[model samples]
Target chain A: MTKAVSSQPKTKRGIERRAKILAAAEQVIGEKGFAAASIADITRAADTASGTFYIYFSGKDVLFRELVEDMGRATRSQAAERIATAANRLEAERAGLEAYLIVVRDRPMQYRIVEEARFVDPDAYRTYYSEFGKAYADQLQQAAERGEISAGDAEVRAWALMGIAKTLGERFVLWEEGEVDIERVVAEAHQFICNGLAP
Target chain B: MTKAVSSQPKTKRGIERRAKILAAAEQVIGEKGFAAASIADITRAADTASGTFYIYFSGKDVLFRELVEDMGRATRSQAAERIATAANRLEAERAGLEAYLIVVRDRPMQYRIVEEARFVDPDAYRTYYSEFGKAYADQLQQAAERGEISAGDAEVRAWALMGIAKTLGERFVLWEEGEVDIERVVAEAHQFICNGLAP
Candidate 1:
């Protein structure tokens, strides 16, 4: 697809203004949806003039694509930091899952927006997951070779682990009505991840 | 959420007609997404007059909700049929995951529609997964009591398993570029389900 991020802010003030617009867009689009959410609404939420949006993003589609990419970058950075300190691949998996759920809890709007990308921006959505899946598979493969985790189809295992993390984040964090206990979720899920459903 | 599916077709001919409209609507909405797809587009796909659409459902919202429900029912029935013969919960999980991927392969459009429901009809989407998650946890709890599998937190395990099947279906069945080997996916994932990442 054509690069939707048409411009990049060069100065600190410009960067801050762009970040404000993106944050506003995430909340507006998350609540109202991609189709119903308007650029004016996003700008209004950002407390900026509507014309100012063009200085950062070329259009709504451009801005939406940026949000999808942003979720990937943000989640990866967060997960990577925690994963770095893990003792092994199994430990890394636990850390990564926890990091993912924490991100979902903090910036719930971003989570919703990324899910919306499946419809609004199909290519971006595919790239977001597949790219993450590829990188995740690479890590799992290296782990298996290092004898830190069981040897199996790393790609399949990676997607499965990613799935487990994604759904838990949705059910326990995003859609939860009462107080969330993410620690309990991580502990229980980590048990299953480390030791299957065997009796 | 105001009960968009207004009426149920009574006569056989009416049932047939309504079925035609729904099948067409699934295709149209899957291709163009929920908001961009219009009643006219659905009717044209059905090879019927635009007004004929109103006979079955109230509006696009109702039809979209029905499509989301349809995926859940179809998947559950298919899975139940397979799971009934499985010797234990682990076997049942394998059967269920296989059934899910097969459905994704066969009715890809329906899969897209249900995913779209996350944004198009949030309540229905929540109900769809939560209901399934609850029932799945029930089965896991029962199996745990029977000494068929090790269990820690049934609810957390249920959502995590659902996540694995959902993502695997998306990547292997829905988004695959080459010939689909669903049997391999089922086998590989079932291995992980019965035995996690431990070496």
Candidate 2:
């Protein structure tokens, strides 16, 4: 395994350059995929000299791994922020699902990068979801104890809920033709999440 | 997109040869991924000459598309069989989820190949899930009419349910370290599916 490079850059100029390269990388790699997207392409897209790429990272592999990790953090933080305002676990589920769908719509490249990681960097992909799953399960467990939700296996429920958000995002938001009605998807999916299919 | 090869075999021997090639392709392609696994690798695994591979398929891309289609059919058929005996749509959902988890466990290669298709053959991946989603939504719509399940957006519900099964399969079965207690996972997930998290 290639040891991933540091995302942190020291100087403000260095930081801006690094951020540019990272943003360019997400565009290049997400569009062209990890194997096909070359460092030169990324650096070119970043409008930097080819050598500037290595100043921030080791290689494409390391940068791809970082993208996967970055996506995980961004998504989790976004969902947490949305869920923070919810009145209860049920409402939190609704807010979290809505936040996820919106993120997929707004930052489509992040979703592509993370999906690509399943093949490009299996460990990073696993870590990304596993970390998110663990955190989600912990919250679910607490919610169950508080009588905010039904008691069930937190781990299984967490993964299942993650699955719901994921597939719905893919189908309703990403694959939807013409104008996307994310609010409608969130409402319908949230009802299923809270009440399920029981009449 | 390269036109996918015909999965249908003309003769008995042709059927056997094609099946051999597909089974070996699944093993090779699933293990090594689409790009890394060559027609030579697949033929070698099949114990057939490289020239023989051309008879069954044009190239790796065509064969991969076929594999994705095959996986979709196999999973849908298996789930349908299981759901046939279910007393209601809710029961069908349980049987279907269980059936899906078992397929992922037993035919782990198919799961890997389909995931690979997200990058390798985006159209096939979309078609694969969309076809399944449409049929699933149709079932949910009918079930709602019969009052077997709650009235909701069937399309939204179908994809959400599929998302649950897909993620749970990835986490609990395909990624499991050892002996898998699939029944337990199914029970836990099905409970949430039918009743959701509302206390």
Q: What residue runs in model 2 are displaced by over 4 Å at the alpha carbon?
A: A1-4, B1-4
In candidate 2, residue A126 scores what lDDT?
90
- Per lDDT, the best of the predicted structures is 1
Relative to the true interface, what fraction of contacts does candidate 1 keep?
0.93
DockQ of 1: 0.89
Per-residue accuracy of model 2 over B1-199 as CA lDDT, tens digit each: 6665655679999999999999999999999898889888888999998998888787788888888888887888888899889999999999999999988988999999998898999999999999899999999999999999999999999999999999999999988887898999999998999998999
lDDT of 1 by residue, A1-199 (tens): 5555568889998898899999999999988888899999999999999999998887899899988998888888998999889999888888888999999999999899988888878899999999999999999999899999888998999899989999999999998888998888999999999999998
Overall lDDT per candidate, in order of appearance: 0.91, 0.90
TM-scores, all candidates, are 0.96, 0.97
Q: How many collisions between residues are there in candidate 1? A: 1
Q: Give per-residue CA lDDT, model 2, range A1-199, as digits (tens).
A: 7676765788999999998998999999989998889999999999999998888888788888888887777777888899888999999999888888888998788899999888888988898899889999999999999999999999999999999989998988888896899899998888899988988
Score chain A of model 2 by TM-score against the reference chain A.
Answer: 0.96
Name the candidate that leads on DockQ.
2
Chain A only: list TM-scores of all candidates.
Answer: 0.96, 0.96
Give the per-residue lDDT of model 1 (tens digit) for B32-148: 988889999999999999998888888888889899999999899999999999999989999999999989999999989988888788889999999999999999999999999
Off-target runs (Cα >4 Å) in candidate 1 are: A1-5, B1-5
